[model samples]
Target chain A: MNLKNIFKKDNIMPVAVLGIICLVVAVLVAGINLITRDVIKAEEDRKISESLSIVMEGGEFEKAELPSDAPSTVTAVYREKNGKGNVVTLTKQGYKAPISITVGIDAEGKITGAVITSQAESHGKTGIDSYVSGFIGSDAAGVESHFSANHVTGATVTSEKIKEAIYDAFVVLGLAAAKDTPDVPEFTPAGEASLTESEAIAIAKELMDGSYTKVALPENMPETTHALYKRQEGGYAIHLATQRIKWSPTENEAIVTVDGLGNITGIKMIQWNVGYDKELLSAAPVCTEEYLNSFIGKNASSLNRVEIVTNATLTNNFFGEALKGALDVLYPVPIYSIIAIVIIALAIAAPVAVVIINKVRRKKNEAK
Target chain B: MKQNNKLSIFLRGLIAENPVLVLVLGTCPTLAQTGSVIAALSMGIAATIVLACSNVVISALRKVIPDTVRIPCYIVVIAGFVTAVQLLMHAYLPDLYAMMGVYLALIVVNCIILGRAEMFARKNNMLDSLLDGLGMGVGFLLALLAMATIREVLGAGTFAGIAIPFLVGEGYSYTIPILTQAPGGFLVFGILIAIVNKIGPKKGEKKRKEFSCEGCPSAHLCGKVSCAENTELVITSEPEVQGTPEGKEGEA
Candidate 1:
């Protein structure tokens, strides 16, 4: 290749122009970065410091080394200069986005405060302040119990995430010794046996007309039908189990009381397992006394006439099936009567069954 | 292209050749940011700074840049200015920087900036290019403010975070949430464009059509008089300014 051809004007001009423009841009960008690097760092430091002050007040904080066994959600830990507490910043995955919170844990392993610094929760940041503030003065066990019982009504998932972050903060500070729980606890599926005998009787006494005795569930009853209580005044209280949400292991136990005629007298929610933070459980329009009351005066056949909740359609359908099974157990069709009915049905369908079988057999023969 | 005075060149972009409404450029940021007044204001300012800076630099280096490599060169310069603005905003105005998010960096790809650079900056004098950039920037800001005012007031029942008393009262709060959404952005953009068309000076329409072909980046290649009328062929000419090196196009 000739040197003249290598450095030809056509070949060189475009390259030169592009090269110069790129070089100039790179330099300008570098210069801006150089100028802004310190300002940006200082600004970030100021923000972190402000957030730290919000969580653990009246302390000059300095960044501390995070514990080796700290939960993955724990992002940063800052120690108070006067030994007040440590503020642990963590970001846990919420329903929609990562919920970032700073939790303040004192030397005695009790939470002083927890503030949500940033989150893109489904229900937004409003109304969650009280939920987070409830963590104040709680040790690890208290935190767990409080979290298990209460949450921001519609933002349950976000609230649960914030609770996890706060609890992890306690664990990071070696404050979780109050209760030995795993970083992520195993969610046990709520069993049908969760409803106690006394609790069943208490619910029965509230709904039924008089005293009742625990009785065996009829043989053909649905799996969800736990136990039946026969009323002395001519009715029965049925204990039924349903999942709190279809996707969750946690179950909701409900008590449905029926008169001797199998007409539902009253229904009550017995136990709502809140292990898995299913917002739909709390946000459901049907999970109310009024809704449960609507099921009253309806028998197995009449249950379908009850209006269904918009989101809890599957649960409603399950309730209907459970009630039908309970009623079947109450009104046991005689074995002889069932056998006679089956024979009569078979006698009516015998000709149609033969014709369908013949048609299928003829088609197979034709193909062969 | 005819030369206009500094004032006319600057004033034209405000209403006649308004980048968002009249010319319909930079629709993404206009729609995305105009959902809130603060966001729209921040976006407008950030884009304006980048546009003005890039225009001046591109104009100053126009003669030095080879025609074949101009687009890439323009992008580099524009990106550099955008990054610089981003860094500055991150440092000095962190809140606004966080609010603007990726839209600030996206100014590099905004058609309005590249359009002005190609049409006015590369051809006009440095002063005129600077004025054109400023005028277009201000026009963009004004357009964003107009759209944002409507969106923030009606959609959110607030003006720059302050609640409007009549819109949101004690027992009831009234708001059309869809106005802050994507469809609403298109609706508002179309209405504004239609309004600008209805009230705009007739002379601006003719000037707009003339500049459409003359300022097109691909005008040199196609040698066309108009985009719509393919029958008319025209000769592409070099800048008649002094000291422009001859035969640079041939080399390119």
Candidate 2:
């Protein structure tokens, strides 16, 4: 084909248009990129430097190549040029996704500082800042113990992962000792009395006006009931603890003396773990003698009939459940407790059943 | 008359032919970026700049570019503008650039920009295309802001990262987290589209009916009667075949 013919409108015009457009676009993009390239580089470097400064202040650094055996979570490591410490940047699997963290460790293998650089964890209301800060001053020797002790409840997985990564940093630095298979403590069965059998007799003497002897608890003893002691006169003293109160994880312990007929003759609260502020101190029911005395004459079968203390309904309910459970071992008529359990189960199951039924109905309709 | 025409051309993209709500184009970023107001606004501004710049360039090159290679040429132009915006955002607004992530670079494929290039820009002058792009861009920004406001305030109990006191008070937390998820995005997008449809010009309106039929493939069959009754309308710009007999009214 002739050169002029190649330039004809039909043949070359379309190609020319596309080529010219592409050329112009490439030039425009190149120009903008050229202008931004330096700023973008500086910004990225500044961010890393800023993070390093925050992690370990007064430490001059040089990028150190990660070891061949380094964990995949460790992204980059920066060692102090003057032998001050090391700053490690890591991305570890968190509660939701990979959380980026920066850690600084001194020459002594103690964590100088730690910061969560980025995370997608939803438990921002209960932040991991304090939990992460607890890692400071922790060496590999104490890391495992610290990890077990302080955990952010709602953000447990993420917080645990943070500690794990920090510990991994120590391992990367060769500061961690050889891993030992931790000795697992022997498992004690639940409902085993925290109070000794003799201690129960002593507490039982305070509740009832008679000599009492420690007795083996019934086979159906509830998890909350710690020990049982039978009074010589014809009643039993039940020592129990309940940790089922809302907004608190601590236990509430008590001693209840029940007569032979399963009626409570007296009650004493040994421990009240729930805390109330001064403003609500007047309404605090657990401290009042009247509240404990109110349950004195009530039969364990009708424990729910006692007026629940205002603002302490959860405490009252769990305490009642424990007393009822203890009496059931003696009287063995747990009809009201069974009914309550059933009501709770039904409340949870009703919505789930409705959802499943609706799903099935939709499938059937689709099939039709 | 000329001024009114120009104003109408610009104003129509804002609501009457809104690229997101009314026309329903570029939905991916609209849903993905609108979870937070900052991300949404960043995406909106970036997309608008690219749209306006591409529309203007495409309109200027409309005649120079041959019809056979126009789509590829338009894409090149659009991609160029998108890259330029991406570079600027990455350089100056690094945080926003990080937040938007890949969505910032996805502007080249956003249908609103390409759609306007094919439909309005190629046919109109440079100024008019620029206006259309700006108007449509603003419309997209407004729609995203509306959706993000609802999602952030109700779903996250925050407005642009500042806590809404009543929704997230010290002892009280009243947030519906599901509203920030994918399903919520679709729900809000659908409701907003419905509201626009309700308030905007209807398909059966005399103006829309008359204007839509011009590009309708079966216009000759209907003899330009109302398009409201036709369920199988094929929208095209192809010329009517010569010597075809006009069908009777309602035959289509």
Candidate 3:
């Protein structure tokens, strides 16, 4: 029989039923897939955006395309204010995502105001929370390269990732931001503890006369030096000489800007990784700002008779360990400790998931 | 059997009739799908879909085909409807498509669809053949559901994957260690068939109903043989002839 014969008035009912079923199933499958597509895209965007924000400039952030020939990991540009309250824009990376930390730089290149124009990171937090904040009063503005800061600790991996992002952003913007080929901090000196009272005084004297240049560099470093100078109070000072960035012994941390003659002109302590957020210091639930401030006026001298925080005892111990290493050159114990902890935690999670899966399988089988 | 004999035609196909349990014809697909109630359900429905359509088409086109080539012609018609059922399952109920897997495509070989088409559809009255195909299709589906219920419970520890609330939490598990395997599928299939066989039609009673009907030849004289057994319902053996005794002597 011909194909059209199948569609006769006598054969209509069954064919109509089949056609309806097919139409419903086709529409349902297509509709469900279409809805999930946008949901999946949004989820992806949220996750990636969170990571990128960590390295963005402070305040408001914007996403912009990097130039075609940009170098490194730079992907976007950002603008923001600096410490002096003026608009100082620079792109850099720390332990987190790539971000442009814009601060106001004056004629002398001192930071006036600071802001983060853009980043890919969690809101209000990045690897720089404890790293770049160390540069409040410092201006490495005109300086092409060279910088260092104490490890932001607990956020080490994130900090390193941030540094890479900053470099990428710098390349995209085609501008010079702080350049350090891997500015890993020597928080705890290799072998010895930091300087003692008498030792601190002696190192201070050496630094004042610029005798710290005698210390051997970490092999391939570029022109590293240290110095001490007399403050107005007649007490000695400690200074670091890796470009314009400075680390002082008298204050928790101090920045000294010298023009050509190497005479100290502008000096300020932005914030101490171990000290308060500012001159007044922010109080913490575990460690009081007052307790942390006690160490601000004192150096490696009289390092005895201190107590850990009441609630945050371990944090206190860690804080002391960080300080002991930074000023005294204590042993580098934190790195080994962190690596061991991470491995153990991951090992625990893996076995737990496997055991759950295996148990579910075994129980199901046993039932039958 | 006379080509015109409707009762012998419908009964021989329907009772001798049964597609699955008696002839054991569609056993491959029967055993495969009887593991779950839903698979059995959809398979039964899909088969019924093909059977009913094929029978109707064959019945409609019965006179158009040459007798020498009729079996082949009927098989082609049956296969076409089976293809339609397969495509319908794949596009609409994809989950059921996965559940039935290869078995759904194997509806072409279900024998019940083709057997009825050849035995009933090719020889009988269009209306009678269509009814027989429907009755048999319904019977096969009912049998599949019955077998599926038992297999899904004892073997898979599931009553169609909806946890049997009273047996809840105890046997409810993501993995079915034994039933998930092949040997288990076979063992469960056999045990379920045994249960359905036990609780199902008594073999002796089945042999009795098996031959009782011969409604069409002399429906009035063949009183008890007429399917509407309770009444002295004088149905014509030949529906075209009214009050059959008037026409009886001419042939006699």
Candidate 4:
């Protein structure tokens, strides 16, 4: 039969042939990917480990795992020979995305080293990149004793997040210390702290039930910035994000009062910026509506609070900044959006623009 | 007209139908995970496997799959592949797996995998679908590589983390200041899209396109999660079925 005649049948042979060919082709491709991945994974892991060793006190860095119930997301825990039990590298939410870092500490619960193992945060300034190495050889508590890290010189929020992440590491290790798990077992970094949104909510609920979840710095609250959205009967059902919120709840109306940790972590009812006022704030610059909103329903437990941004106006601004900061930290935003949009726009415009530019040139030639 | 060759499969990813740059199919991982070239490449490959494997299985079982549950079946197959990759990566390539974060799991929802299943694999036999899947995987890889190349060099002052001498570090030559921030990605994406669009066929000048997909998005906002199952496909399928001899058979 002629090759042309083969097309006339529209037979299963074509499909069958195609099927067999495709099966072979697909198996081959997938096989290649699997094999290639092995090399790629080895190469990448070696590189990252090499980078980690440079920042951390150099050692074999044995992998450590947290108890299933203990909260944290770190996958591998490395211990120093001195029983310092430091350099727990894992992931954590930073200014943009989950930032992977290796935190180094001494036996006394102080940060000696901090390094970004891998980061999806803002490009250059997780602070883990810039000043994290400075932490090396210093005590893990150096952040508390030494100068506080300001927002990144260029990338403030990102820098602050890294600093806070270091602090979070300290808390994890410190709590481990206090628990008489004095051997200082491995503590989870954020990557291993895979708490989903609902889990976050659940964590908040637990803190309220007299759980000592908040093992971080926090001070007692004296005054609170309050905002009551609606006038109600038998007292207003006050809205509070969390127990960390310092202000007392009295009926429907609530106050934006609380500086650090606990109930007031995120937004609650009428968030600080939107339905509330910027001018009116607590005497000590009680956390703004945004801050209050953050901890709207968080567990009221132990967490040392400090005056991060004092002054009434400044406090509200801090709240606004904090909420925006929180959202910005949570999402990578325009970076990803921009690339996607630009590539698409350029792709579509290429064909049209080419034709238009060509037509214009043609018209000019005709006129000539 | 392109031949099904190794070079073709590789090159196709670089330009013709990039999952990120060209097709704009899997935007979530591209946007959320690619802070560096390493992250992007790892995600691309992981996703590529899921795409390729799922395509093959779906093709193999096409006859057995009842049309009534096609979508669900496709999802189960794709998700199974994704979960397998996830476990494998977690066990062996723990670092890359960890770096990918929630995005690693989010691969199931990635439109690219589903789009390939619905658009190509479901309809075609094993070979063409295999070719198409490979082409798509490469395309996605290229798009991710391109994005990472830009983001790393400009946004972070490094290329694959080598820290180029004059281009970025100490006595750096150039940089988009905003790109170091989150919003910069959007600004860069928009500008590049405009430039790329300008390079293509001019607006309204012989609209019959060459390589563009029939339901491709507007070039400017191509990856904005706009696709929601093209309604026109559903509408037009019935009419198109009436035109051919196959239509009579289908009708019968």
lDDT of 4: 0.54
Interface RMSD per candidate: 5.5, 6.4, 18.8, 10.0
Model 3: runs farther than 4 Å from truth? A1-368, B1-16, B168-181, B188-252
True contacts kept of each: 0.63, 0.63, 0.00, 0.00
Cα lDDT tens digits for candidate 3, A1-368: 23344355545644444454345445654565465556544543453344333433243444445556555454334332332122323445533344545433333444333344434332222234445544444444422232432344444454555444433333344444434433543232222223333444454443343322223333322222233334333333433332112222222233232222222233333223433323322345333445545554333333333554443332343334333333333212333445678999989999987866765666566656
For model 4, what is the alpha-carbon lDDT of residue A229? 21
What TM-score would each prediction reach against the true structure? 0.52, 0.51, 0.32, 0.46
What's the DockQ of model 2? 0.25
Report the lDDT tens digits of candidate 3 across residue range B1-252: 554555454454344446676556687777767767887898888888778777887787777665655666665566566655655554455456546655666777777877887877888767777777777887788767776776677555677778665444664544344553346656665675565456655665566545444334544554342243332233444443354443332433
Which window of ten consecutive residues has the lowest lDDT sum in model 2 chain A? A180-189
Better of 1 and 3 by DockQ: 1
Candidate 2 ranges beyond 4 A from true positions: A1-8, A53-76, A79-85, A90-368, B204-252
Error of 4 at B65 (Å): 2.4
Model 4 Cα lDDT, one tens digit per residue, A61-89: 76666645332545445667657556666
Q: RMSD of each candidate?
A: 20.4, 20.4, 29.5, 21.1
Q: Decide which is better by DockQ, 2 or 4.
A: 2
The list of candidate 4 runs beyond 4 A from truth reads A1-103, A107-109, A115-368, B1-18, B33-35, B91-95, B155-157, B169-173, B201-252
Pairs that collide in candidate 2 are: none
